[model samples]
Target: MLITKIYKPAEVEKAADELRKGELIAFPTETVYGLGADATNELAVKRVYLAKGRPSDNPLIVTVSSIEMMEKFATDISDDARKLIKHFWPGSLTFVFKIKPGTLSKTVTGGLKTAAFRMPENEVTRKLIELAQVPIVGPSANSSGKPSPTTAAHVYHDLEGRIAGIVDDGPTQVGVESTIIDMSTNKLVILRPGAVTREEIEEVLQKKLDTDHHEVGKDETPKAPGMKYKHYAPDAQVLIVEEGKWEAALNWAKKQPYLVGIMAPGIEEKTLSKNFVFFDLGNNVEQASHNLFAGLRYFDDKKDVKWILAAGFAEQGLGIAYMNRLKKSAGDQFFID
Candidate 1:
């Protein structure tokens, strides 16, 4: 077993050194912790898939510190792509672009002609990338099908022995992944909804985008992560509680044979029975989105938690990103009675 070290914020150089040595290291981003490997190193990239138990065909995002780093592999960048990059690069948006043949290995591109790229807002991560002198193939640093790691500790929990180290930079602010836009073709499509909303992207480009978040067939290669797999699911069964259904959901929870977990906003803890473990989702949709994955992870640690009744929000703005992840976790099941 490898000794997984937690690199302090001041120790990102060491983390970068590990990446240079072709070892897997988890680093913080505005969205979430990313399991990073030298994108140019086929062996390192392949190890990332093995470490996360991720499918080979679900392409990983090549995280760059600069547009030049992305330009090394991605080509045929469109005007709209440049506009979005000018406005949202160094932030929570990833773009898929046609790649120059042989620039990136098939391991990083999933044998596709295109690849996804992002420049994260986190300074330490950018410095690590710059120091390493190569863009890293970054996918959420967790076991496959699990909630994305929002903190360094979460990464350690899921990938301690499997990885080299984690660069600890506290909890992620966006608390979700970046919005992925496919600009490789004429029809601009959103393959994943995230901290960056559809409205924000539309306003930036002055054009609406098609939502192409459908499941990828068994033989197909997904253009982006989260499109071809069951993602963000916890060990406990998650049931989304739609608006105005909290009372019914809680009542239903009280009668369950096993301990039920509650993840909602503004619920008085004292009013709940011992049968339910309450995880407050905070006051508004933003806070709820920020707290969603952490709450799911919390319930998962409690071995008795067999059911999780998580609150749902309106699919608008950031809520769209929030609900997107929640829906996948809950398998689109809402409280019915």
Candidate 2:
């Protein structure tokens, strides 16, 4: 399966046509590249799992062209959820709702009663959805448990012979996954945090959003795909530096015997003890969120590196979401120095 690269509107339309025909298409979103298939087509959606090696129990996020299209997938929408959507739709927020009968497939919904849906802010993704004239199930376009792809080149490198088409729209601006909120119950439960923060969602809904940490280690069933397992991990062992210890941690990392890779916001230190690869993801939370996955992939490709030393961001606003993913990727192997 040769990976076809599409750039112009004509090429996008051609690829979208293939998507409408039930073929899989890899397209870019602000968060990450998504391997998309017709959401209503069970067979088409299955191709997404097969192509990415994603488990059947792991669900996919559905992308729609508009709120009306998104509503079609939900059995019922709460007033709070609607308000949040009004304020954050076409962005990096995903709302989980009860699936309407005959609207989507169990494969796309993970055989659950509810479905995860988002309307991407990316122009190319929206255009692809509109051109295809159907809702599409879009999971990050990489093998399951691997770092999500943020650029066309990343998608091609990981899935070149595995998928049929990829829309190379350059690097994704928001380099993380969507913030997932479950609207099934009265209280808003944050299933997964990403570019969107709980404070922003609560501000729009005027209600406190509940955080669920139970999914962190439950062996039974995961509420969302990311909750069940460690994801966005690179090939190297990753260790997260505790907050406010960036300087000390960097120094210690340099003294380590093995080659080290450091990903920090802007703090710089001398590299003397070992070979190092450093990435400065601007001081702003948005910039850090946009570069998280790309930096992980960079270190993952470097053969000389044996371990990754990452700095912890302040758990305020989007920084909290960034740290959530960072901690999860490191798993229980990380500690404060």
Candidate 3:
């Protein structure tokens, strides 16, 4: 693992000290552990891209301790954007806003005109930002194109020796990334879905939000992270089984003569048959979202697991975010029959 020191929440001041030195520190957020750097420090942000092996064109999300800090780095916040930010700040809602002139490194924005800014509700994250005294652009602690890390251990596994330090505040409360909204548009667009559903935002706004979800290519510039990458996939290939056809899927797997990895809700682990490694994601959509990536990472370590059969979940609430990751990781491989 890459952690030289795993700091506790009480030690955020030390982590912040590292940040001011233009170092990369992995810290816990409400959504996931992020590889954080001083956003305005060009060299520090460059280390983040290098440590994650992230594409230079893929912009990072600048996390703030408060609304006042966000204003220092972002500009041209519309009334609608301000309203949504007032409602969702200190939560898992990220907004794409126009950047202030020379406020952040070009690397942080990928030289784009706009930048993503967020205020995660996790206290540890806020404390770190408060201590650092600058906007911190934090992407998932894992390497580029990997499942976003929800725990510090996952961060260590993917970025060992690459980062300066890690703050182990335990597993994240929201197991997925934040919901990103493109307020740079005339009409707000849902760039990425997460624990905070679109419905929740609409309820606060009393207006419909545009859903903008088309996978982008590596060669193109995506409006936000998770928009155009093969993300959240484990080493084994994963497939989503259509509803009511799970029985057929089980039978098909039984004929393969190879061990199968299954991530499904309502799984009868004690009664399930065959040479299979079963991961119970629970029946509740929120539970599934919480356990989804951890389950995938669990199955990834299984030597006999070659394919993962995941039960389809309704795209409502957290399920929308869960299914989005599932679809990307599954590589469009859905069980039709």
Off by over 4 Å in 1: none
- The best-first sequence of candidates by TM-score reads 1, 3, 2
Evaluated with lDDT, which candidate comes out highest? 1
Off by over 4 Å in 3: 1-3
35-108 in candidate 1: lDDT tens per residue?
99999999999999999999999899999999998988889998889999999989999999999988999899
Clashing pairs in 2: 175-290
Lowest summed-lDDT stretch of 10 residues in model 3? 1-10
Q: How many backbone clashes does every candidate have?
A: 0, 1, 2
Q: Scored by CA lDDT, what does every candidate get? A: 0.92, 0.82, 0.86
Residue lDDT tens for model 3, 1-337: 3446789888989999999998889989878889899998898898888888888888899999999998887888998888888888889999999877877777888778899989989898899999999888889998887778888888888888888899999998778889999988688899999878999999998999978866576588887888866788888889899779899988888777778998888768876667788998888778778888888888877978888899878888888898998888899799766
Show model 2 residue runs off by greater than 4 Å. 216-219, 269-274
TM-score of each prediction: 0.99, 0.93, 0.96
For candidate 2, the per-residue lDDT at 218 reads 47
Clashes of 1: 0
